[model samples]
Target: MLFYNKNILIVGLGLMGASLGQALIKRRQSKDDFKVLGYARKQQTVDIALDNCIIDQGSSDLESMAKQADIIVLCVPMLSIESSLQAIKPFLKDQVILTDVGSVKDEVIRASKKVFGNMPNYFVPGHPIAGAEKSGVMAANSELYDCHQVILTPDIYTDKIALNTIESIWKFVGAHVVEMNVEHHDHVLAATSHLPHLLAFSLVNTLNHRSENREIFHYAAGGFRDFTRIAASETTMWHDIFKCNKDALLEVLNSFTADLDILKEAISSNDEQTIKSVLSEAKTAREYFTEVLQARSNK
Candidate 1:
């Protein structure tokens, strides 16, 4: 048990943090190895988490909790992570292993270096590829991370022991842990996660501005619903993400735009072959993803 008899401090009682607390509490029911405590900027969020029994205790005093924690997981948005790290820096124990669930990692690591004067070996940056359009503690669930991918971006200076401990905790919560460098992680996520979300939000807004908006939504099919589901995600969180990871996001966006132009030209010029080729390629790519998901499930 990596967290055996440890006090795990989860900062931010939002969807990721609350769900992690629930998973830790569920694990404790059998092993009694770790205790989960929570901290949130809002007292109401802390109270809600306590009332839901997601956390063993809750507090707004981050420094106090940081001093007592064996592991600290920052589950706040990408932009808030820097401030969160700075808040706990004064009290952060040398032995404490720190990690985060922020989607963008390069900025988090950069912030860590700025605050600490160097990247601390105990700080293992991570991103969990699991979430929903829903936000807040009420949307949290213990099974949110089950079978999900959690990527850890650790450099050569990172402590191996701390890396192993963080990996073990994620695995305990039924996540498939993978390791990669910060740049690669950011680039991959920009293409796979960020671009899709941006497109979803943009598409929804475009449709909403049309005169037939109500009719469009009323007659929307499952495909439209599935594609735009992420558009309902918290605007503030995504706004921060876009700002923090603009470079990688823009690179992916340009590629996607080029693809869109190709399709637009194909249709405009009445080129049947080009249109069919694009559709066939997209279908193949999607089917490949389905096959990969099924294979992982079978394991």
Candidate 2:
């Protein structure tokens, strides 16, 4: 009902975009209430989405879709988001509400400003804090965002109506919407999401490069699999995310390095008390995090 009688165009029919199309289709109340259109660079993605009934229509031409769209959601990677914006800028109607699902917000905000000269009042910058290790339309699911957090990083110049519409759409898709500034979103996500992925990728690569990699994998258990699951995420997307949020990522990486050094020194010195204290602290933090997650889920 939030987007009643609206033509919503989704750019890039990958995991996030395809999932969004499915969500919107599930919420459709009448033939005229809402329509979902998807555009991807690959015609194969469009064909797959159409066959799955994820979108009412699909196309490889972005400009034509943008011309008819009342709302456009950019589901492309952080690095390509600017190009997508630029491509559709010439075709966007004055009332079109533009938004994105990129993980990094600051870079997106900058990109929009660069393309439009001034940030468009209708552009709402957002990040949906949900995904899987898989990529592409085949991996999309309507339940992917159910009860997940979606953060909106709106600037002062953003239109109130447009922001509300974007928030409503995410909430309708079963996301718990939250709002913050772009800088804070980047900094927090760097510590919580980006750093972990970086560590996972590094750990898996380091182990794979060793001569004993076969043995290492043979002896690996659930813990290794759990930690390395995210390392299987699409490399191109992660590469763009890391590049866009490098400053915030670097800050968190340095802090993590310092903590790692402390653990290394304790282990090398065979300091039983220090090691015990560190592990105890980590256990306490982990317990607290679990409790927090449980509480959020209950909400």
Candidate 3:
């Protein structure tokens, strides 16, 4: 299950896929043990990836590329995972390892099970906790994953050798790899990543629809702009992620809504002590979080 001398195909040459290809291609330049290939639905995307040297070979054909791939890393949207799995299943070689860079793990597992009728032994579900608000092939960067966490959720059906090979591949790109079960991964992400994006999109959308939208945006401060930066991310991708992880997302959203109501009641009642206590606790928590990140970086 060694990745060395293998043909690693990256399906969907978008930001994540192209960045991964760039990282792998850059490393193989010195080692020359493997090759990096890319596939996109659009020929124009393949051409752009080739022009940027993000891949050793590029194509718009999935079947042809899947046939030659010793390992396939799906980098498509959450909703597209099932379709991609269905398309590539018939062409996958016996030992070819299947992995993905999807944010939601539960949906991926469900899709895999639905497509293959059971979990494929060589299919290891993965999610790299790395990305940018900006996307597409032109936004590809070789260092996008450096020092970031990559989570792998391997079930009993997952092949040990395939898991190890996928872990090694992530490490090769300078990522700190970790493992978690599908449920834990999805719940953690729902609270941390998905909720924040949901808030950002909601805030922006709410303000944009107001009658004074122009004046509101004109007077927006740096903090407001920074907090909403993720609102600028591609809509279709987030839309799919929200739908795929709705159960978990809704759980967290409900919790946040209850907390928000408490805050609103306190504000309406002018409860100084309640307001001060909540604010102080949040400030302390943020400071502790900063210290933790600093400690990790120093390590």
For residues 1-299, write the lDDT of model 2, one tens digit per residue. Answer: 56888999999999999999998788666658889999999899999999997899889998879999999999999999999999998999889999999999989988988998877889999999999988999998998899999999988888999999999999988999999999999999999999999999999999999999878988889978977798999988999999999999999999999999998999999999989999999899999999999999999
When sorted by lDDT, best at the front, the candidate numbers are 2, 3, 1
**Model 2 clashes, total count:** 1
lDDT of 3 by residue, 256-286 (tens): 9999899899999999998998899999999
Clashes of each: 1, 1, 0
Candidate 1, pairs of clashing residues: 5-33
Candidate 2 deviant stretches above 4 angstroms: none
Residue pairs clashing in model 2 are 5-33
State the lDDT at 153 in candidate 1: 96
Give the C-alpha miss distance for residue 222 in model 3, angstroms: 2.7
TM-score of each: 0.97, 0.98, 0.97
Give the 10-residue window scoring lowest on summed lDDT in candidate 3. Answer: 24-33
Q: Model 1 Cα displacement at 226 (Å)? A: 1.7
In order, the Cα lDDT scores of the candidates are 0.90, 0.92, 0.91
* Model 3 residue 1 distance off true place after TM-score fit, in angstroms: 10
